[model samples]
Target: MITIAKPGLLTSVQDLGRYGYQKFGVITSGVMDPVAHRVANLLVGNDEKEATLELTLLGPDMEFSEDTLISICGGNLSPTIDGKSVKLWRSVWVKAGSRLRFGGCKTGCRAYLAVAGGFEVPEVMNSKSTYIRAGIGGFNGKALQNEDELEIGTPSELSANISKILADQIEDKKFAEMQWTISSEFTVSSASKPDVRVMKGRQYDWFTTDSQMKLFTEPFEVTSQSDRMGYRLKGPELSLEEEQEMLSEAVSFGTIQVPSEGNPIVLLADRQTTGGYPKIGQIATVDLSIMAQLKPGDTVQFVEVSHKVAQQLYLDREKKIHQLKQGISLKIRK
Candidate 1:
C-alpha cells in the first residue's frame, strides 16, 4: 500500500491502454512511452500490461505503508527514497514507512513507476488507464492527489522470487543497497534533440514542393501549448495549392494535421479519434515514444521513411520485448 504525499503537476495510473473501441470514437489512453513503461514493469516482475503510476513533467511524493519493490524508468527525474537519492531505470526496495520523492525532470516529460504486483486500480472500458478528459478509469477517474491511498495487486510468483533474492543480495542498510540498475541497451538514442521518422500522408501532394522540402530540412520548435493530446509546431507556414474542407476520418496516433493556419499539430496518445484537417505526415510508432518526452521549446526534425520500414521497425521492437521477457523468466527459474 502507498499514500500520496504530494501529487505533482499531473500523475495518474495507466496500463497498456483501452483498445478495440476506436470505432466508438474512443481514443486509446496508455503510457506515452510504452518501451520505458514496459521496462519498469519488467524490472519489478510485473506483466507489461500491469497498471503503474505515470508521472508527468513533475512527479509525486509518496509514502509506503508496507515494504515494497518498485522500479522507475523514463525521464531523468531525480528520485529519492527515504531522503536518499536513487537511480532511474532501476529497481529499489523501500521499507515500510519510507517516503519516495521526485524532483522535476531534466530531459523528458513523463516517468513511470512500476511497483511489484503493479498498482491495483478499477478498470473502466476494460482498461486501468486514466482518461482525464473523458472522466473515466483509474482512481475514480482522476489524477492522484495528496493523501490518496493506492492498493497493489497480488504479486506473481516471479515477483515473489525476485524480491526474496534481492533482499538476500543487498547487505547494506543504506539506500544504495536496495538499488538495482536496468540495462541502458534498451534506451533509445536520437541523433539530435529528437529524431522522429515519418511517412508522407495522403495529402502530402497538396503542399507546394518548396513547403514539403522545408519541412524535412528545417527544425521545428514545440509550442508551450503541447500536451498528451497533440504537439503544436512552429516553423515555416505551409501553403496549400487548393484549400478545401476535409472530411472527418479515422486518424491514428502520430498523424500530423495541418490546419488552416498552416502550422502542424502532431496528434499523440490521447488524441481525438477523428480529425478533418489535412495530414502532412505520420510519425512512426517507435518514434512517437521519443516525441512524447519532448518539452516545450524543444527542437525536433522529421526524417522520411517508407511505411513498410516503419512496420518492420515496430515488429522488431515487439520481438525484442518478447525476448527480454523470456530471458527474465529463464533467470527466475534458475
Candidate 2:
C-alpha cells in the first residue's frame, strides 16, 4: 500500500491506453512515453500493460505502508528514498513506512513509476488510464491528491523472485539499500528534442511545392497552446495550392493537421476521434513517444520516411522489447 503525501504537479494513473472504443468517440488516453512506462513495469516484473503512475514535469511525494518493490524510469528527475538519492531506470525496495520523493526533472517532461503488482487501479472501458478531459478512468477519474490511499495488487511469481534477488544484491549500499539497477537498451539520448519523422498524408498535394520544402527544412517551436490533445507548431506559414474545406475523418495519434491559419497541430494520444482540418503528415509511432516529451518553446524539424520503413522500425522496436524481457528472465535464473 502507498499513500500520496504530496501529489506533485499532475500525477495520474496510466497504462497502454483504451483501444477499440475510438469508433464510439473515446480517445486513447495513455502514458505520454509508452516506452518508458513499459520499461518501468519490466524492471519490476509487472505485465507490460499494467497500470502505473505517470509523473509530469514535477513528481509526487509518497509513503509506503508496507515493504514493496518499485521501478522508476523516464526523464532525469532525481529521485530519493528517505532523503537519500536513488537512480532511475532501476528497481528499488522500500521498507514499510519509508518516504519517497522526486525532485524536478532535468531532461524529459514526464516520468513513470511501476510498483510491484502495478498500481491496482480499477479499469474503466478496459483501461486504467486517466482521461481527464472526459473525467473517466484512474483514481476516481482524476489525478491523485495529497493523503490519498492507494492499494497494491498481488504480485506475480516473477516479481516475487526478482524482489528477493534485488534485496540480497544491495544489502550493503546505504542509499540504494536493496536496489538493483536494470539497464534499458532503448536509449533516449537520440530522442532528446529530436526531429520527428513524418509521412505525407492524404492532403499532401494541397500544399505548394515551396511550402512543402520549407516544412522539411525549417524548424518549428512548440507553442504554449500545446497540450495532450495536440501540439501547435510555430514556423513559416504554409499556403495551400487550392482553397478547399476538408471533411471530418479519422485522425490518429501524431497526425499533423494544417488549419487555414497555416500553423501545424500535431495530434497526440488524447486527440479527438475525428478532425476536419487537412493533415499534411503523420509522425511515426516510435517517434511519437519522443514528441510527447517536448515542452513549449522546444524546437523540432520534420523528416520524411516511407511507410515500409516506418513499419519495419516499429517491428524492430517490438523485437528489441521482447529480447530485453527474455534477457531479464535469464538473469533472474542465474
Candidate 3:
C-alpha cells in the first residue's frame, strides 16, 4: 500500500487506455507516453496494461505502507527514496515506511511509476484509466490527493520470483537494486530532439501546395494551450486551397487538424470523438510516444511518410518491445 503525500502536477492513474467506446464519443484517456508506461510495468514484472501512476512535469511524494518492488521510467524527475537517489529503468525494492519524492525535471515532461502488483483500482468500461472530464474510472475519476490511500493488487508469478530475489539481497537498511538494468536504447533519450513522422490525413488535399510543403519543412512550437486533448502548435499559418462545407468526422490520436485560423492542433489521448476541421496529417503511432514527451516551447519538425512506411515503423517498434520482454524473462531465469 501507498499513501499520497503530494500529488504533483496532474498525476493520475492510467492504463493503456479506454477503448471500444470511442464510437460513442467517449475519449480514450490514458498515459501520454505508452512506451514509458509499458516499460515501467515490464521492469516491475507486471503486465504491460496494468495501471501506473502517470506523473506529468512534476512527480508525487508518497509513503509506502508495505515493502514492494517498483520501477520508474520515462522523463527524469530525479526520484529519491528516503533522501537517497533511486535509479530509473530498473526495479528497486522499497522498504515499508520509506518516503519517495521527486525533484526537478532533468529531461522529458512525464514519467511513469509501476508497482509490482499494480494499483488496486476498480475498472470502469474495462479500463482503470482516469477520464477526469466525465469523472469515471481510476481513484474516483480524479487525481490522487494527500492522505489518499491506494491499495496494491496481487503480484504475478514473475513479480513474486523477482521479489524473493530482491528480498534476499537486503544489505544495510537502504533500498535494494538489481545490478542489471534495461538498455538505454529501449528508453527515449533526454537529449535528442525527435523528428516526428506523419502520414497524410484524409483532408490532406484540401491544403494548398505551399502549406503542405511548409508542413514538412517548417518547425512547430508546442503552445501553452496544449493539454491532454490536443497540442495547439504555433507555426506557419496553413491555408486551404478552397473553402468547403464539411461534416464532423472521426478523429483518432495524433490527428493533426488545421482550423480556419491556420494553426494546427494535434489531437491526443483525450481528444473528442469527432472533428470537422481539415486534418493535414496523422502522426505515426510509434512517434506518439516521442510527441507526448515534448513540453511547451519545445519545437518539433514533421516528416511525411507513406502509410506503408508508417505501418512498418510501428511493426518494428513492436518487435523491439517483444525482444525486450524476452530479454527480461531470460534475466529473471538467470
Candidate 4:
C-alpha cells in the first residue's frame, strides 16, 4: 500500500481506457499519453494495459508501506526518493518507509508511475480508467485526494526477480535504479512550439481556401481552458465556405472540430462519442504523444501529411514498442 500525504494537482489511476461503450454515450477517459502508460507498465513487468498513476503537471508526495519495484516514465517531473533523484524510463527499487516527492516539472505535462504488479483498483466497464466528469472508474471514481491509501497488487515472477537484484544494492540507500534505460526514440517532445502532423478531415474541402491554407501555415496557442476532453486552440478563426446543417457523427481522439466559433478544438481522450462540428483534420496518431505533452500557452503548428505517411509512422512506433518489450524480457533474466 501507498499513502498520499499530499495529492498534487490531479493524480488518478488509469489503464488504457473504457472502450466499446462509446456508442452508448460513454467517453473514453484514459491516460493522455498512451505510450508513456505502456512503457511504465512494461518496466515493472506488468501487462501493457495495467493501471498506473497518471500524475499531472504537479505530482504527489507519497509514502510506501513496503519496499517495491517501480518505474517512472513519460514527463520529467523530477521524482525523488528521500531527496535523491530517480532516473526515468527504467526500473527502480524503493524501500519501505521511504518518502517520494516530485520537484518542479522540467519537461512534459504528465508522468506515469507504475509499481510492480500494478495499482490495485476495481475495474469499471472492463477498464480502470477514471472518467472524472462521470465519476465512473478509478479510485472511488475521482482523482486521488490527500490521505488516500492505495493497495498494491501482487507482482509477477519477473517483477520479483528484478526487485531482488535491486534489493541487494539498496542495503542502505532508500532506492536503487537499474543501469539501462529505454531509448528516447519514443519520448514525447516537450518543445514549446512543435510541428504536429495531421490528416485532412472528412470535410476539409468545405473550409474556405484561406482557412485551409492557414491550417497548415498558421500557429495556434493552446488555451488554459483545455482539459482531458479537448484542447481548444486560439489562432486564426476558421469558417466553412458556406454553412450547412449536418447530422451528428462519431468522433475519435484527435478529431479537430471547427464549431461556429471558428477556432479549432482537438478532441482528446475524454471527448464525447459524437459531434456536430465540422472536423478540420485528425491529428496523426504518431504525434499524439507530442500533443499530450503540450501544456497551456504552448503554440503548435500543424503539418499536413498524407494518410499513407501517417499509417507508416504509426507502424514504426509500434515496432519500436515491440522491440522494447523483447529487450526488457531478455535483460531481466540476466
lDDT of 4 by residue, 103-215 (tens): 88888888999999898889999999999988889999999999999999999988898888888887788999998888888776867789999999988999999999999
Name the candidate, 2 or 4, with the larger lDDT value. Answer: 4
The estimated TM-scores of all candidates read 0.95, 0.94, 0.97, 0.98
**Structure candidate 1, residue pairs in collision:** none
Over the stretch 111-137, how does candidate 1's per-residue lDDT look in tens digits?
Answer: 899999988888888999999988888
Give the top-scoring candidate (lDDT).
4
RMSD of each: 1.8, 1.9, 1.1, 1.0
Ordered from best to worst TM-score, the candidate numbers read 4, 3, 1, 2
The CA-based lDDT of model 4 is what?
A: 0.91
- The regions of model 3 sitting more than 4 angstroms off are none
Q: What is the C-alpha local distance difference test score of each model? A: 0.83, 0.84, 0.90, 0.91
Clash pairs (backbone) in predicted model 3: none
- lDDT for model 3: 0.90
Model 1, poorest ten-residue lDDT window? 173-182
| lDDT digits (tens) for residues 1-334 of candidate 3 | 9999999988899999999998888889988899999999988889999999988888999999998999999888899998899988888888899999999888888889999999999999999999999999999899888888999999988898787788889766658887788877667666455799999999999999999999999999999999888999999999999997768999988999998999999999889999999999999999898888888888888999999999998999899988888888788888
Model 3 poorest 10 in a row by lDDT: 185-194
Q: By lDDT, rank the candidates, best first.
A: 4, 3, 2, 1
